[model samples]
Target: MSVAIPIFKPVSQMQLTPGSTVTIPDVTWEEFESILQELGEKRASRIAYNQGNLEIMVPLPEHEISKDLISDIVKILLKAKGIKYQPFGSTTFKKQGTAGVEADACFYIQNYQQMIGKRRLQPDDPPPDLAIETDVTSKTTLGAYEAIGVPELWIFDSGKLAIYLLKDGKYIKSEQSPYFEDIAITQIIPDTVERSWQVGSFQALEEFANLYLSIIE
Candidate 1:
């Protein structure tokens, strides 16, 4: 007797516009992985999967600009302070059978060396010390990072930067970064973002670096 194999219908590429989000319900992990693979790195950069639902987002120029500028500022500060750090931009951090997220930018600060030689990060390993979300369009809920147990998260939206510290299995909004306790994100990032439009990102970064130096010097 011959057995028949059930064939799943091909999932179509859902059209995505800049600054837009599309969520598909009842998606399996396997299906989500397939979709990610199908979308490839370029198109799948901002996708997230939680439980049985998947959300794909396309960031606008404003979003990308802000994300890059903020990341650059953070890097400059870390360097100036002689802090050991590593940046993992938009890397998909996922734990099987639970949830996954592609942070706008992530960093290993206190735990940079632990990820030096590893290609893929597993759930059992140390999670990135910080995860950043630049939310010009779609807002990212804490549920995604909470599943992976990221210790700290920075969310920038609507000309304000909010810091969240992971405490007791939940994220509580804080006024400053848990890692960089002395720095005030709200005081610096919003103004820097506004200045970037006038002076451009590179020059804006230089200006911010100088400002950071003046503060600590």
Candidate 2:
């Protein structure tokens, strides 16, 4: 039985009101997945649907202090370092109840290009090199990856961060991942930057930006 939890929605501004007569669109799981083909970029919007009859209501991340903060921070540093990555998961969780979590940020190392062949990536492909999550600590998102057997995962609370790596089909707490050593617990979240805004804050990012320019010189 699917239950409708009264959780806050991302596009709450268009709340359904009594006698308002709103048009709620409906689509099948296959159609929903087709969206990614057209959008060309992973969406941060959470969606609804069912899998084997289990109902779900995954929505785009709201004003999550941690997700916003960490995402921007990682993006700035990665860009400066000439690293290529994409933010996947809950920000783009699957709508059909598959581990449709879009992490605040997802990193794919140079080796990731190997997964690309004549066509798109295959199902057996490994997960992103690094997965950065925010807000709730529950395993809903993590569980999804576990089902697909992702190798590494990271989650950030308001001020704290956790990194997990897959081992023998299960995850264990560790300080590092073979993919990216810099994202290890020791360096991922230092005291200097905690809030989502601070990750890409003008002052902090500018400092790194200047350093990047200097390196190029």
Judging by TM-score against the true structure, name the best candidate: 1
TM-score of each: 0.89, 0.55
| Residue 195 lDDT, candidate 2, scale 0-100 | 25
Against the correct fold, how does model 1 do in TM-score? 0.89
What lDDT does the true structure give each of the candidates?
A: 0.80, 0.51
Q: How far in Å is the alpha carbon of 103 misplaced in model 2?
A: 2.2
Instruction: Report model 2's TM-score to 2 decimal places.
Output: 0.55
Question: Which 10 consecutive positions of candidate 1 have the poorest summed lDDT?
Answer: 135-144
Q: Model 1, stretches more than 4 Å misplaced? A: 1-12, 136-141
lDDT tens readout by residue for model 2, 68-97: 555666666666567766544343434333
lDDT of 1: 0.80
Q: Model 2 — which ten-residue stretch has the worst lDDT?
A: 47-56
